[model samples]
Target: MEGLRHAREELRPRRREGGPREDRHRRRTRHRQPRRPSGKRLHRLRRARGRERCGGPEVTATIAYDRPVSNFIDKLSATGHVTHKSYKKTSVTLHHNGGRLSHQGVLNVWKTRPASAHFDVDASGAVAQYVKVNEYAWAVGDTVGNQRTISIEMANETLAPAWQVSEPTWKNSARLAGWLFAKVIGERPSTGNLFYHHHWSSTACAGPHMDTLYDKVLAAAQEAYDHFKASHPVRVSNTEPFPGASFFHTGRKSPIIAAMHHRLVAKGCDLYQSHANADVWGPGDVKSYAAWQTKLGYDGAAANGTPGETSWDKLQVPNV
Candidate 1:
């Protein structure tokens, strides 16, 4: 019993000493100052991470604070056709064909017609920019209002069988329009800024498709504007090669992949396939990787296959 009591007494002091030491350590930690954010800042850090994952340039342009197109400084340049004239600038207009022209035939019409617009968005979602935003085109005809408004012509052949715009076409047009709205209005285009051709004229220009796509276009524009505002620009690699790898042969080319390659090339990535290539990812992809590696000072002779962290990092794939 005596030995046991002695041992307990000896251990109790040690336990007491340890408890106070831990408590003092925790209290000191609690009183210490909090760490500040890094030099990049929280928002910038998020944007940088997003760019790393998306493998593309971070969208940075937005229309949140932009001025309306009418407020643009260069709205008096009269250089294009003056089709139909109007006197009112109260409404934004939209238009579509009334079975008078085919999708492929629009170029000829625009060249020969007295009227032209700022944009011609095709059913395939391919947009052709004809007139500059600040220039006065003959699209709306009336001399007084022609210089004050922007016009867009949607591609359509018929309005029967319930007017419908293809998914790709609608989405692409919405994106383009949204970009234009931001550029002109100094803010993203909204439902208020969007209008149909028939809204200003007695014609059914945008056709039945406009009814279905109106809300969608507005929503898409808003989404794009938000994304643009939250994005940032960062330096990215322009290569597509991985070391010690072989290329895979996918028989079919994905349009999205081809589009990605084209965007990369436009930003100075060296790709083997020309813009006219069949959108296929193959040896051409290897060429792109090699080019990126060369840019990054990698000279160890890497080939195309599954891209590695080095290549992806260079691509600035957004981390999101």
Candidate 2:
């Protein structure tokens, strides 16, 4: 036992000559300032934090859904976040990610968060769809707004305090908005139908850069919508042949007149005021038809309110 004790004592660390807590007490550590991260280290740290904030990298799995539109590059279904109930989309609500989020980043975020947008446009103008257009995306901060709107989330090319999208992103967004206005809403692109996220929510979404360029973007969208309409005109089949010119005379009451009125209004020749378009012909119909005739290069008497067979055929009025 003594020999064992001696061996253990020899294994113990020897006390120094100072005798100030050197025999058995633990040494106290001196406090020193931490070194700041270098530029590259800071960048890496920011990137790592961003990934965490956006729910890490992109997910490969997705749910089965119809690909209604062909413009998008791919789809990452936010099925967990969206409402399965279908909605009648009346307008489009635009939003910005408020950070430098990529297409996959936006999808990744939606996977974990309870919120989602129907579409996300990246910095390079590539589009990624999340929630289906017919369903409700938990965006816009309001239930009615979500039910009525097709929400679009845009990625920032420049990071916040600026949060500006790239030129290609803006152009592609405008193009997408135009297509939606024409095909989805079946109406012209206007401020009434194309709305910002701030319109419904209390937050300043869409960012400052987009807010400044709202009018410019709206104008571009209008132009693109016009182009889309011109390129893809509605092919309404004529179920009824052109009635005689006398059929367009005053006191005429027929479904054909109402159909013609609708067609004329669609062609941007609306002259109705104070009353709805009816089957009975009236001064409004005359004026509207005259405007249509003028648009068809008719002049003088030829451009009179009377509907000519050539103009009537071109109008492509549908049967009631």
- On TM-score, the candidate that comes out on top is 2
lDDT of 2 by residue, 1-320 (tens): 99999999999988678687664343544454578899999999988898889898544432221112222223444236777788888898889887767766776676777788877766545456776677888899998999999888887766778888666566667777777777777888788988889999898788888998889889978997887778745443434446557556676566668888889899999888734647889999999999999999999999999988899898887744
TM-score of 2: 0.49
Note the residue pairs that clash in candidate 2: none
Total clashing pairs for each candidate: 40, 0
Tally clashing residue pairs in candidate 2. 0
Give per-residue CA lDDT, model 1, range 1-320, as digits (tens).
99999999987855445587798898889978888777669778788789889986543232222211111112222323543343333324456644433333555665555566666655434455555555566665555446666776665533665555555455655665665555464566665666666555566557666777788777877776565556553233233222112122454243434654664576587556465663666666667756766666666655333445566556653211
